[model samples]
Target: MDDATVTAPAPDEDIDLAYDVFARSCPSRHTLEHVTGRWGALTLGALSENTLRFNELRRRVDGVSEKMLSQTLHALERDGLVHREDRQTNPPRVEYRLTPLGESVAERLLSLIELIEGKMPEVLAAQHRYDGRRPA
Candidate 1:
């Protein structure tokens, strides 16, 4: 073995993104779609801690496109999960805080995420066994 070689644990961010959907998409599924969006869960999680400006939110939730972020926020706002407040100032200041319903949803989502995190190792092992190939 090369003594100079070193291996640190790989980032778990990618693997942590599996449970990002509900059932099949349909025209009637408006609110659930908004609540279960790509950035929605993370956005809710961030806002659960405290109010944040749009830029701050973007920075906190990694790997989100600007357009997608705006869309997600707007959808949540329309559905009442998020509260968007705009300040009438020179540069324009905006802040997002969760609504009461949003807080409840955030709590549930966080708990679900925690459960997934705890079982992820076992889930991956089962997946490998079912597929007959060890994880790389």
Candidate 2:
């Protein structure tokens, strides 16, 4: 099928959408994975604050290898979540920033990150309890 149109019942109404993320074949799943993956999430979060060049972004993301960051940037750029600007300068300068859609995604992702960070104490306690039950 060229597109998948599914009718989902909402709390107040019936909604018709062209794509369903829950469906296995939906393209949104890949996009979601890219946005939520460790490196991708960190990259988006870092860019959420400022536009950065390659090395600067690499440094900001901390542990990401050069190749991985390059690949991540390329994927995000292809997904329309990132904008890459190439400037004709003495040595040439390239910078990456979020597109409008990316800003929206990053804003939501940051909220999720903040929530996870804030709940770490409780999460750690739960982890301790769970691990206590495991065999040595």
Candidate 3:
């Protein structure tokens, strides 16, 4: 569909304001999965810096195969969180960047990642203690 036809989910109708993600049919669950999936998070994080070409993004994300990256980008693009620009040129250059909404989400993800990294030592220690209690 064209850009004009694309629309965000309506606040009042389609997505219930009181929807619980724990429920099987909640639309938020699908959105959460798309935004927080391994490649999705990384892709958003990488694009938070600036626009990047396909290969540049692939390299930045590290270990994500081309197919997976493409899929992640497509999902983000469909969600209106990522902008894909095609520069008409001899070689068909394309670049990806986070939309404003995407930047907001990416910033949140970066903060969460930082918090996890800061607590990793404590988490690892807890894991070690838990593992120790298990019978061999």
Candidate 4:
């Protein structure tokens, strides 16, 4: 990921995308924010496969608060990583999908997911070792 970026959100100023995560402040931080947030990465990864309604998204992603999910969607939408569509239908149909940019990030995240899953046992062991309890 030579091109990943990072940055802090400023309420009133234009974001200066570092365009490099290692940069002091990557302008692409917005995308990273979406990918690593409580509901962001999951949402983007889920949507990468196909579009889904709010409920569907909720079902696919576990352990996310409604408020957090909503916030994540809004942020991703603002950053152009996600697309929100409101349709005229019974109770109104709203679906979330990822933009091409988000898809790129999702592809990267997929590998990350694999890496994390592969190392889960080791991670848990490490955590347990430092969890303040003696090892059995």
Against the hidden reference, what TM-scores do the models get? 0.72, 0.87, 0.83, 0.74
TM-score of 3: 0.83
Ranking by lDDT: 2, 3, 4, 1
Residue range 1-136, candidate 2, lDDT tens digits: 2454433355587565567677776777788989999999999999999999999999999999999999999989988999999999989999999999999999999999999999999999999999999998
What total of clashing residue pairs does each candidate reach? Answer: 0, 0, 0, 7
lDDT by residue (tens digit), candidate 4, 55-111 = 889889998878888988999898878999999998899999988888887899889
Give the TM-score ranking, best first: 2, 3, 4, 1
- Best prediction by lDDT: 2
What is the C-alpha lDDT profile of model 1 across 1-136, one tens digit per residue? 2223233335664443222223343322476767767688889889999899988999999998889899999989987899999989989999999999899889999998889899999999998798886455
Model 3 stretches astray by more than 4 angstroms: 1-18
Better of 1 and 4 by TM-score: 4
Candidate-wise lDDT, in order: 0.81, 0.91, 0.88, 0.82
Give lDDT: candidate 3, residue 127. 99
Q: By the TM-score metric, which is better: model 1 or model 3? A: 3
Q: Go through the candidates in order and give the C-alpha RMSD of each one to the true structure.
A: 17.1, 6.1, 6.2, 6.2
